[model samples]
Target: MEQKLKLWFTEHQTEDYGITFRVNHVYESEQTEFQRLEMVETDEFGTMLLLDGMVMTTDRDEFVYHEMVAHVPLFTHPNPKSVLVVGGGDGGVIREVLKHPSVEKAVLVEIDGKVIEYSKKYLPNIAGGLDDARVEVIVGDGFMHIAEAVNEYDVIMVDSTEPVGPAVNLFTKGFYSGISKALKEDGIFVAQSDNPWFTPELIRDVQRDVKEIFPITKLYIANVPTYPSGLWTFTIGSKKHDPLAVAPERFHEIETKYYTPELHTAAFALPKFVKDLTI
Candidate 1:
């Protein structure tokens, strides 16, 4: 007999940023403690899994999201020897960061250990990079970890989920302050800010929060198929250098899929609609 596929939509709406938000219910044949999971998907973007049946990422595309999130900030730094990744249990972010030869250590702080285990089992392509010896996986609260982290890292990447649930603190001023304190004086920080098309308030709020703490704050955009809208935004906070100021020659040795030296320069060139929000 053929197995049955059971999935139903619970709620769907269009947010202010032009991205579609969705919540779904999934049913499985076996009886499990966690039977249903929330699946978020965007019309122009990719899908994401929240729990058991929750589909966090999508098939249409995910490379752009992973690549841009990791490479942009690492490449911005003159030499990044150590890196920290908060909430990227899937390992895609770590994979990209390890590409840099200068990196000596990569720490992954994931709140849920199951997310990492499940991703490794189900999504090999995305989770494969965590196996690298240089990576140190710490299963705990990122906020607490950052708060206690003695100034050791050169780059910190906040690859967290939306500003809801446990992820709420990751977007607050307090977290940014903790991130600022966790880094070296000249360290660089970047995060996966929500899609500007779907969450303008979030983008505006994060930009405001980071600007208050960092000497240089900038917002950039990328096209990820699994997110709400096809468009996504990443906010970069620098302690002493401008990301856009990376010399063209320095990027030649780096291998990239979505971000080129030209694209890196262009990503910061936000459209007027987005540019208006930062001010």
Candidate 2:
């Protein structure tokens, strides 16, 4: 009798702990100019995209992060005609932004062209919106894009990965100030702050810095199993609009799996430990 061996993939979140996955196959593995990229098939999460050994997205739970990042700010602002998406080459966030009829143009700036190229081929459903008439894909630096623009965007979503490698500068105070300069008077911007359990200081620093630039700053949470911690946080900074005070009429029918009008406020209700980071 012969025994079959199982193949597994593990992401070390910390020195002591990590999450492991059962990989059925590796579809693509290559070294891009910016980072190491890999797309693998898994039984639990379907197709998974990894950058520098970190899980970027998976077929199973992408909607949660994309919807929460896009819809919350879009609905908060009275009108979001121009949207800037920083680092979301996977195109999930752009797909959600286009759902709002008011969005006339959506620009995506990703430093890595390989992420955009391979994602479109491997994760078609998630990356489908990049080819839409209203979208302009730029293979450039998001930080530089924000620095160059002046009062251009109505909504800006920083759909970046963890604050490391190419994304390290994206998490700095100067970048948030640059975002403030890039946005229109009533513009709203959201950035994914790392998980509270693992990186509470990062969230606290982001909240502190964004609060100084934008009058309305809030924190929200979402559940993403493949990420470092099951719980993830997003920091939102608005020049004038308050996400918590979105009007009932502003909420419109949109195709979504995890985000809803009711859950909009609920997502902001953070656990005590997580809420402590905001102050």
Candidate 3:
């Protein structure tokens, strides 16, 4: 006699947030179409999508993650003409960048064409902007693309996974330097740092590495439910402009869900612990 497997889910409440983590699921389907990813649904978090059985993002609170990741740096930059997005196969970052009127061209450099296709089908809301004429989607290694591109972009956004598997190289100092070389003199680069609660070491290392390449670097935080620890950080590196110095008048025109001019300013206001780690 063979044993039947079971799946269980647990939910917890924290101050103003609610989280639901799942464990043990029965075998459903084994389909490797594009990116070898899995899509599942949860009672609390809505839909849960996983690439190679690893959790990507959940439906219930994906907006918080996507919005903050894309808007903060785009809003801070006064005029971002040519923008490049690395590893954002889901197109969430592209969607946010298109919201800015000053943006002329947005390019998406994704390693897996399948991730983009899957997101476009299963996650329409997140992948909606890829169809825009302003967006030019490129399927290839973003690191190699950055190395080859010289002074090609005004803003670069790295919406990648954690430091693991193929994404490991993206976090290296060499890659940061290449990103610096790829950007226009006044361009800004922003990448998703790890969660402050679970991966502070990663955050510290990335902050240190980026500081060596760019004149000004800053760390900011956003709350996202699907990610480990539910709190994530984004590290911004700039050559000429400071993210903290956004003009007050610009705030009136920008529309955002989570990141506001006030929040954008406050996001850089990290606590003593985070500040110590980066500095």
Q: Highest TM-score, which number?
A: 2
- Residue pairs with backbone atoms closer than 3 Å in model 3 (clashes): none
Ranking by TM-score: 2, 3, 1
lDDT of each: 0.77, 0.95, 0.79
* Candidates in order: C-alpha RMSD to true structure: 4.3, 1.5, 5.0
Regarding lDDT, does 1 or 3 come out ahead? Answer: 3
Ranking by lDDT: 2, 3, 1
lDDT of 3 by residue, 66-128 (tens): 778777777767778899999988888898888888889999999877777777876788889
How much is the lDDT of residue 173 in candidate 3?
A: 99
lDDT of 1: 0.77
> Candidate 2 lDDT (Cα, whole model)?
0.95
Q: Choose the strongest candidate by lDDT.
A: 2
lDDT of candidate 1 at residue 14, scale 0 to 100? 56
Per-residue accuracy of model 2 over 1-279 as CA lDDT, tens digit each: 854238899999989989999988898999999999999899899999999999999999999999999999999999899999999999999999999999999999999999999899999999999999999999999999999999999999999989889999999999999999999999999999989988999999999999999999999999988898899999999999999999999999999999999999999999999999998
Ten contiguous residues minimizing lDDT sum, candidate 3: 23-32
What TM-score, over all chains together, does every model reach? 0.85, 0.98, 0.88
Error of 2 at 160 (Å): 0.7
